[model samples]
Target chain A: MTFLRSALVPILAVVLAIASGAIIIELSGLNALEAYKALYDGALADRKGIGRTLEKATPLVMGGLAVAFAFKAGLFNIGGQGQLVIGALFAGAVGYGVTGLPWIIHMPLALFVGGIGGALWGMLAGVLKATRGAHEVITTIMLNFVALNITDWLTSKVWREPGIIVRTPAIESSAEIPRWSQLPTGFALAVAAAFACWYLLERTTFGFEIRSVGLNPEAARYAGISVSRIVILTMFISGMLAALGGAIETQGIVGRYEPGFNAGLGFNGITIALLARTHPLGVIPAALLIGAMEAGGSTMQFKADVDPEITEIIEALMLLFVATPILVRWVLRRRDTSEISVGAHWGDA
Target chain B: MNTLSRYRWWFVTAAFLVAFTLFTAEFQQAQTTAVLAATLRQSTPLVLGALCGILCERSGVINIGIEGQMLGSAFAGFVVASSTGDLLLGVTAGIACGMLMGAFLAFLSVSLRGDQIIAGTVLNIAAIGLTSFFFQTGRSLPSGKTSRIKLGPLADLPILGRVFFSNRPLTYLTLLLVPVIWYALFRTTWGLRTRAVGEHPSAAETVGISVVRVRYMNLILGGGIAGLGGAYLSLEAVGSFERMMTNGKGFVALAVMIFGRWNPIGAWGAALLFGYANAVQTQFQFRGWLADDPQFIGMMPFIVTIVVVAGFVGRARPPASIGQPYSRE
Candidate 1:
């Protein structure tokens, strides 16, 4: 009964969101059922559809893990976009700039560089918060703009391939993450990373320390945990995970460092993290659901003349409903028993 | 010495400006005037957005939804103005839309005691999605520009006139609003009660203040101001709405609020500084100094925000219970 009660809110929220979306569609003079049918068909019909969904889900899973990991440490790493950008930049640089290296050395080296870049970028905000009392939220948002302009400058000026196009050269063949006949290898890596995150958060002492700090920093400090160190380490790991996602996307799907190609993947991480209730393991399914919507968005747009941005609307609605689970409980007429305050550690922690 | 140390960044910025002007011959008298004028114009939305942040944060609400509110208002303003050909109607529509969003935020974060940041994030995503979706579906509207207001004698003043007198009505209103907001926040009895509620809600309640009511009012008012900022973007700045047209200005306004230490006048100053950076970047592009690659130049304001927020300027202290939801037991 407890489990059912806990699950009811999310389920009801999703249903309500879809119903609201249906209303909007109907009001727009479109047949809601036909539009939904097109959405489902595009998302699940063919092998290509499934592949695209997984392909999109791969980055989302990694990004979701990044956000969820930080949430466990009571940090909102809004710099996921910035971190991912730097990671992709370094990975792309390594992928195209380096030569004569075998695939075994090249691929991992590119990924490592990307991870390090992301980690370093993430550490900037962490270090600022730890030392200077600057808010991570503000710092991270600023970093996003900085990252965008930096990447744009680099691609358009420094790393340009002597062409008019504002993108880096295509990565070498050796640097690519080799895929199976149909499946992207990055998807498999994402699943492994998700499990690794789950294991790290659930089965490790470090994870315990992180959760302790998240639950109560004063207690964690009294318990002899170095709060600042943990915060920095957690942000570093979170950034590395997000960076790895961007690197994989560049190597697996995009093949180049193009501005705007990886746009919103980081922001979408917030949705994925919130929808997963900040659980590392739950991020996989949440990411997959969002990924499927994104994968099918174009198809839906083409088939039903519905805008692809409707997926974004649905995602946002889900976030709103999930964020305010009280509304769900009120609609369902359930007594309030959950004591977990999501923003308990918002500012001080 | 303390004042000098506190305002050291101001002096440094002044020195940098002088040196920049001396080095760049393109920054002639006419170019300087244009840049100054553009800076004031550009800062209008930022000032209004900062006011929104100030009002919300002062009342103990963390409104990261300023971006979303601005976007919603921009869309509302653009649609109404284009359809009705009445700028005032458009502006009102924008403010109403913003207030609606503010009310929703208040309902979720205040009354329901939901996670404020998550509520804000949800608001942003929903605003972007809804606006873009509607924009895609709706017919393209007229893109008539807002007529500028010119003061007779004030416009004749050399540099000050160009910077302050000649602008869209919204720009003037934004400037006028700073002192008004400052007075309301710092002078009035209502302001005192609001601060008391923000700092110590239980105590405020004991003193007969309605904490929820104060927060809701401030949030809605902030939303209206932010909506005006958004409306300024569509109706005055660009004459049309685009997807995500606020372009992180709302977030930057939060930084401005912090830089100003949650003071309206301080926020206006910070907004002007940021606006100057943007205007200078535009001027550099115009003069072919950046060779059309203004991307690096564009990063100035954000980088500067980080430096300022990292306590290089001065410490920014938010309200005591800024992000906390007050529940009267």
Candidate 2:
């Protein structure tokens, strides 16, 4: 009964968001039923469609885990975009820079380099927050612009593909992550990462310390847990996970680092995290749902003459409903028993 | 000595501006008047956005939805102006749209007691999606630019005329709004009550002040101001709306608010500083120095924002209960 009650809000939020999207479609003189049917068919009907959906879900799951991990430590790391981009650039460089290496060594090296790059980028905000008392919200927002510009410059001038195109050279074959007939290895990696995050956050002593600091920093400090260290380390892990997502995209999907190719993946993480209620395991289904929407968007546009941005509207509405769970409780006529404060530590942190 | 130390950043900025103007031949070679004019023009939306931030934050609501409000207003202004060919009506429509967005934000953050940041983020994402979706539905209106207005006689005054008088009516209104907001925030009784509510809602309620009402009023007012800023973008500046066209000026306004230490006049100064940085980058691009590397030039404002927030600015004290939702219970 408790599990059903807890799950009711998200399920209702998704249903409401889709209903709103249907209203929009109706207002636009399109048949909502037909559009939805087309959307579902495009995302799940064929093997190719399923592959595309899984491919999109892979990065979103990782990005969701990144955000959920940080939330457990009472941190809002909005620099997922920056970390992802930096990781992609570093991983791309390693993928292309070295040659004549075995697949095992080269792939791992590239992934490690990308993860480290993201960790360093994430740690920069962590250190600033821990030492200088700078707000991560502002710092992370600023870092997104910094990352965009730096990566653009690097691609255009430093690693230009010998043409007017602003992208790096194609990565070596040895560094590529192998894809099975229909499923990509990256999807498996994302599922593994989610489980690993769950274990780290729920089973380990360090995870307990991180949770304690999140709950009450003063109490954690009195208990001899270094709050600052945990904050920095949590951010590092969060950033590394996001970077690994980027690395996988470069190694498994794109096979090259192109500007504008990975634009909204990081921002989508915010939506996924909120939808999942910051749960490590919940990230998978939430990511898969959003991924399906994105995968079906183009087909919806092509067949039903609906704009792909309808999907974005649905996602935004879902975020709004989930963020204010009170609205759900009110709609369901349920008493608010346990209040999980999502952003009480926002300014305080 | 204490006073000197307090305004040290101002002194340093002034000294740097003076040094750059006097030493850099490029400043003289490139039309200095043109640069200054551009700086004022660029700062108008920022000034208006900062005022919105000031109003909301002063009333204990943390409004990061300024960007979304601006974007929504910009779209409304452009659509109304295009449909009616009346700039004034378009501007009014824009302000109305902004108020509606503010009301929505208030409903989420204040009534629902949701996370303010999340509410703001949803506003931004929704604005982007709604505007883009509507825009894609063959609703592209004819492009028409708002006419520039020049103040009589004052327009003839030397360099000051070019910098201040020779611009659209909206720009002048934005300039006039700075002092008005400052007076409202510091001198008026309503402002005092608003600040009291922001500082301590329970205490304010004890003194017969309605904290929730004050927040709602200020948030709507701030949204109107931010909407005017957005209208300025479509009607006065770009003369048309594009996808996500307010860019990140709303976020920049947040930085300006922090830089100004939440003061209206200070926000104006910070906006001007950012405007100056933008003008300098444009001048560099115009002179062909940064033509090949526009990305770095595009990065100037964000880098300067980071530097100012990290190094130059001191600890910014926000309103005590800025992000907290108040309830009578």
Interface RMSD of each: 2.2, 1.9
Clashing pairs in 1: none
- Chain A TM per candidate, in order of listing: 0.94, 0.95
In candidate 2, which residue pairs get closer than 3 Å at backbone N, Cα or C atoms, i.e. clash? none
CA error at residue B284 for candidate 2, angstroms: 1.6
Query: What lDDT is reached at residue B107 by model 2?
Result: 85
TM-score against native, each model: 0.94, 0.95
Off by over 4 Å in 2: A331-342, B1-5, B21-30, B136-143
True contacts kept of each: 0.68, 0.50
**Residue-wise lDDT of candidate 2 within A1-349, one digit each (tens)?**
8667666788888998999999999998999998998899889889888888999998899889888888888788888888889888888988998899999899999999998999888888777777666666677778878888888899898887898777999999999988899777899999999999999988999999888877777888999999889989988999899999999989989998998766877669888987888888889999999999999989988898888889989999999888774876675587563533445555554
Clash count, one per candidate: 0, 0
Single out the weakest 10-residue window by summed lDDT for candidate 2 chain B. Answer: B21-30
lDDT of 1 by residue, B23-115 (tens): 553647777787778778778888998899889888888898999999999999988888888888999999999999999999988998887
Q: Pick the candidate with the highest DockQ.
A: 1
Docking class of 1: medium
- Please give the distance, in angstroms, between residue A92's alpha carbon in candidate 2 and its true position after superposition: 1.3
